[model samples]
Structures are given as structure tokens and as C-alpha cells.
Target: MPNVRPGEKPEIARLPLFREMQEEQRERIFSGSFLQVFPPQLTLFELGQHPDFLHVLIDGLVELYATSAGRDTTMRIVEPVTSFILAAVVTDMPYLMSARTLTSSRILLVPAALVREVVKQDCALMQATMRELALAYRDMVRALTDMKLRQSAERLGNLLLQQERRQGGNGAVQLKAEKRLLASLLGMTPENLSRAFAVLGQHGLEVDGAQVRFTDQAALEAFSRPDPVKDDD
Candidate 1:
């Protein structure tokens, strides 16, 4: 329902196949596809649900989570221009995670059979798909490793520093999601997150609410580095 339509400028189409394919190939992929729009907080699929289509996320963020015995845990957040429920689509398994829209989004649905057809006929598409899956796996491994190897406060500090880097030096930074979600993503409880902020300040992180200013950029970066410790670990 939000402004999910392609703007005046030519849209990238958000599919690796779409980008590499010729017009005919593009047409083939879209032959029987459908575009659906969803509002923010919309749940597209629940955990353990069977995935019927290979969904290409054209716009907006999707939060993936899991629930068991009435307990829900946020897993990851997918930004626009990526596939949602990719693991299920690729392996023909029920979704291990649920996807909910973090903002208004437009999704392109391609039948799984047609997606397989494209993979077979188009070598580039197949390769790109493999690369995407591999990268996703690598990221999961890294996240797991970080969690296992770092303390909660350190992990939260690193997450904040990474976000600052992503936003090009932390001026007017935004979380892009609620604090609870962010806390989950960092593998810390909300109260722990608050303590992490205080810890960072003790270690020289300047925090003014959401807009964290760095009193000493070099000191902060050094502390955030993998092999260094400033005042404390």
C-alpha cells in the first residue's frame, strides 16, 4: 500500500538474473510472475510454512524470526533487493524462519518451477544464485563466530561501531528498526544493551542518545579493533 512502485528512473529490478538477462530473458522470468504490495508490519510467511514461490524483495526490509512454544526470537533482517525465504525456495523445505515486513514493500513472486527453469537455461543466473547462497552462509558463520567469541557488551559495542561505519561516520545515525529488534540482532537483551552503552562510555564511547558522538575517534576505533583493549575488555 506504500509507495512501492518503480520510480521514474529505471529501476534495477532487484534480481541478479534480471540485471544480467536480456530483455527476452527478463520476459521469461516475469512470464507468469506477480507483484504484491504489503504494508509495514505485515507477515508474509510464518516459521515452518511451506514456501511456494521464490520471492524477490523489491523494496523495504523484512525481519526473519523463529518461534517455539510461544517464544519468539528475531533471527535476521533482510534489506531490500534480496531474496526472502531463499533457503526454503532453494531446498524445497518449510521455512525455518518467519518473514515480516519492517516497512511497506513490493515483492515479486516467481513460481518455483519457473525459477528452476531459469536456473537451468541461464548459467549466469545459476552461478549468481550459488554465490548468493554461499555469501549468506558465510555471514551466518561470521555471526555465530562473533557471538561465541565475544562478550555481550563487546558484541553490542562492535555492532554499534559497525552501524556507525555503515552510516559513514555516525552523524545523525538511525537504527532502522526498534531497539528490541536491534538488541536481538546483537544477541543481547535490552537491559544489557543499555549497560553496553555505559560500558562503551567508560571505554571512551561518546553517546548522546541515538546520535552517538565520538569524543576520540582513534581511541574508539582502537578499542573496537579485534586485538586491542583500552581501559577494559
Candidate 2:
């Protein structure tokens, strides 16, 4: 279970858009935001639902996915200090993907109408929002390019490399999410993930349960052949 708390005005004020806004604007936005906590696996919202709030993740992870033909495909993982489904909220359209908690999480729900109002009145806020949207679009493009150009094994290798980077290039890294979820995020089946791991083993990647230790980082990187243009950290 997750614990809920009153929304902290300072927290909302510190966000990029709010930070740039005037004090009155910041207060107005904060006044309408509410803080909530959610337990793991709780669905925050469903696909095709009208956007009501701009959900800002203060802590923990949220998985964004879409279902088609009864198969769920993981789209993106929302990390802290970020908002999800912003385009939908801004456009007053239904969400294209569903979101759920990956772990116990703290989130702030800012009313979509309020956000739209502020954006309309504040030029700086509008510019900041446009910048965020552009970056998000670029990230989506990179992800699509990665999926199209790389094999599943290579994708897994790049993911491990990213984890290693997060750990300050340490040789050892631990999987934060479950293997099944990781497989989905990488656009592969559990069986395919297993095979990818096996293939990586020959290139000096060692996996023992959730922990992964790279015996030879150079060899692994060489095998993965990651392209910086297609892969972003």
C-alpha cells in the first residue's frame, strides 16, 4: 500500500514550467494540484479516457502501455520529476496509452483545464511546454529507430549498458523492474529475452538472477555495436 500526503506547494513550484512562472501563477497552479500515493500495479488511467489531470510523478515508476488485439505493449516508463500524457491533456483529447504504477509512488495531479488556461495566458509557460513536447517527440523517434534497426539481443545489450552508465560505469548492475516487464519494454517475448541473455553471455555478459555483471565491457559493447544517434540515455 502507498501513503498519501498533502500536496507541497514548494514541490510544484520547483518544476521547470512553474519555476519560470510568476509567483501568482505558481500559486494558482499549486492551489489546484493534489498529491496522491499509489501502490504497485494500480492503474492510474486507461486508454481512450479523456484527460483530466496533468500527472506529475514525484517518486517511483509508472508504466505507459497500449493494448491491441488483446496484447499489451509497453510504451514508456515515466520517471520522477516528469509528467505523462501531456499532449493529450494539452489538446483536451483522450489518452492514447494507459498508465499504471510500477512501484509504490507519489504523484501530483494538476487539473488539465488550469494548465490550459495558464498556457494560454503565459508566453513563457507556452514556450516551455513546447520545448518539452519537442524533446518527447525526439525521444519517441529515437526509440522507434532503435527498434527498427537493432536486433533484440542488441537492444538488451544497450539496456544493460544504460544501466551500467546509471551505476557510474560500474561493472555490476541490477535490474530495477521484472524480467517480463523489461522484455516488454524491449519489444520482445519472455522466451526471446531468455535467448537474448544467453547470446549476450558469449560476449562476456553474465546474468545471475536480477544481478548482471559484465566480465568484459569492451567485448560486450563491441558485440552490441550501439549507435548513439539511435540510442539515447
Candidate 1 C-alpha lDDT tens digits along 1-233: 22223351135344564676556655676656777778999988887778888777888888999888987777888776778666677777889988889999878777776777777777777787787787778768767877888887777666666666667864324567777887888777889888877877766577665667666656655665543321111
Local accuracy of candidate 2 as per-residue lDDT tens digits, 10-85: 6667887667887777677777778888999999999999998999898999999999899998998887788888
**Per-model TM-score versus the true fold:** 0.84, 0.90
Candidate 1, lDDT over the whole model = 0.71
Q: Over all chains combined, what TM-score does candidate 1 have?
A: 0.84
Q: In lDDT terms, which candidate is top?
A: 2
